[model samples]
Target: MSSTNRASSDDEFIVVREILSRLGDKWSVRVIHEAAGEPIRFTDLKRKIERSTPISSRVLTRTLKQLERDGLVTRRVYPVVPPRVEYRLTELGQQFLHHAQEIMGWTMEHQTAFETARREFEAQTTEQ
Candidate 1:
């Protein structure tokens, strides 16, 4: 193991934590994933995102706003009879998705290990 990994300064650690806290957010990462490729309308995104895990419309709106503020997503509005709005991933957001995809893949691959560990832990605790 690298010494730097173990010995990052307090300030550096906090910075890393903040970055992870944002990127690791439940809605943000999924929102970015859904926004990838083509621009998505709010209603479509809401439907698509909830196909697996349900997210509140309120939380989804808040997540999108946060992402826009962070420069990770772009919000485009159109003038029409009814206002049309779409969200797309910014360049930075695409780059983030590449990393996020890797992490997600790794987690999927290792999930069985996690389940096994949890079962073992529970067994040990029950015996104790």
Candidate 2:
């Protein structure tokens, strides 16, 4: 397996890694962003998040459920002829999003430098 697939052995930031993993998760961030402002139904969320359609419904469902369990998202179900389920970010979730978005801003700001370094490093490796 590639290094990316290997489990991290460094314990220095294991907790940080675990926490960061959730935000970096393929669906979690998108789902959170999509459900940020107001309560949204599953189908609407699925459509609002770009490229999320490729993520299996099962995976998305599980992600939403886990987020709910973590108190990051509130799930509401309406008792109607056809049950309506919606999700919205909890207060805790909003706080988390604030920080996460801040970090994302930092990354975006540095993305060009990061990409430049990556390209330089790759060129050196390929030449060697």
Candidate 3:
């Protein structure tokens, strides 16, 4: 790890946690993945993400803004009928997808073990 990443403190750890927490939301990941291929209008994105999480307009706005501020997404506004707004991934966001895919692969590979562990854990708790 780099010196900066190696520096240890509760606050620094919090920063790392914050970064992941923002992307860890179901809506955020779904939004990013859905919009990855091309720029998606606000309503289109709202529909796609809401299909999975029922995200409120207010919350979606906040999530998109957070992603934009984090340099993961770019929002563009167009002048037209009622105006048009679209969002797409930035290079860093595109790169992050690779890590996400790796996580997916790991989950798939260990799914059986994960289920077994969960069952064992629940059984042990019940026995207590």
Candidate 4:
């Protein structure tokens, strides 16, 4: 292949990897899922996510910021006495969530097969 072609391929690979790395994060996925229907307050989101996975306030804040930077989530602050902040998914985020859900469904459907493959692989490795 030409050097230019190789360089293009490498750049594409890097971009895809970066995107996957961000979206594949557990906290990111959970946050996206939680922010699906309506805008959610920070504390409420934290509480809901913590019910399944424990996350610190700092980590959650960082994740939200990253998501916002990536244009996947939006943060809105209400001008009230106590101040209010809410997070919601953007259109792009919704599209991503739809694809992620499909991938999740596929994984669930093949979970048993995955487990069996892992067990076989482990057995073979241990035998050697």
Candidate 5:
């Protein structure tokens, strides 16, 4: 293959890997899932996410910023006595969520198989 084509392929691979790294992050997925539907205040999002997994305020803030930078989430500040900031998913984010949900469904369907595979691997390793 041509060097130019190889360079382009390498660049595309890097971009895709970066995107996957961002979306595959635990905090990023949690934030995206919680931020779906209506716009939610930062505090509320934190509270909801914490119910499932504990996360620090700083980490949440950083994750939201990253998601915003990736164009997956939008942050809006409301003028008030105490400033309020809310987050909502963009159209692209919704599309991503749809795909994620499908993958999640597949995982659930094969959860038992996954568990069995893990058990078999562990048993074999222990016998070594």
Candidate 6:
């Protein structure tokens, strides 16, 4: 078996690497952003994102836990029928949103390039 790795100076790469390692996670940023508007029940969060397409429950739970562990999200549990859990963004999480929004804004500015690449990728796959 073969392995690949990336190497760079700690001072040169740590910050960007750390940011990507967290935000680059599949549902981390999305789940956090979804919780930004208000505190949302666990089920509500799952449903909201799944409206576009279903995400595995395991993945959603895992992402929420990571966000919470990183001090970027807050989770509240209620005692009642069937139990209730709510999630909201911590101040740090809101700060993270600023970075996310900047990336999104850049994507919007170059959306044409994204579309072109997607079409090219699709064309290459179909040809094979």
Candidate 2 RMSD to the correct structure: 6.7
Rank the models by TM-score, top first.
4, 5, 3, 1, 2, 6
Checking candidate 2 for backbone clashes, the offending pairs are none
What TM-score quantifies how close candidate 5 is to the native fold? 0.87
Q: lDDT at 14 for candidate 5? A: 96
Q: What lDDT score is found at residue 109 in candidate 3?
A: 100
Q: RMSD to native for every prediction? A: 4.5, 6.7, 3.5, 1.7, 1.8, 6.1
TM-score of each: 0.76, 0.76, 0.79, 0.88, 0.87, 0.72
Best by TM-score: 4
Candidate 4, residues 23-113, lDDT tens digits: the string is 6787888888988989999999999998978999999999999889888899999999899999999998998889889888999999999
Candidate 1 to truth, TM = 0.76
Which regions of candidate 6 deviate over 4 angstroms? Answer: 1-16, 113-128
Report lDDT (Cα) of residue 109, candidate 6.
100
lDDT of 6 by residue, 23-127 (tens): 677788788778897899988999999988689989899988988987889999899888889999999899998889898789899999999999999999999
**Comparing 2 and 4 by TM-score, which wins?**
4
Instruction: Give lDDT tens digits, candidate 3, residues 1-128.
Output: 66665766666888778778855676677767877888999899889876766878888898889889988899999988899999999998887766777877899999999999999999999999
Query: Under the 3 Å rule for N, CA and C atoms, how many clashes does model 1 have?
Result: 0
Compared with the true structure, model 6 gives a TM-score of 0.72
Pairs of residues at least 3 apart in sequence or in different chains that clash in candidate 5: none
Q: Which regions of candidate 5 fall more than 4 Å away from where they truly are?
A: 126-128
**How big is the positional error of residue 113 in model 6, measured in Å on the Cα after superposition?**
5.5
Worst ten-residue run, lDDT, model 2? 3-12
Model 4: weakest 10-residue lDDT segment is 18-27
TM-score of 2: 0.76
RMSD of 4: 1.7
Clashing pairs in 4: none
Model 3 spans with C-alpha error above 4 angstroms: 1-11, 51-53
> Which candidate comes out best when scored by lDDT?
4
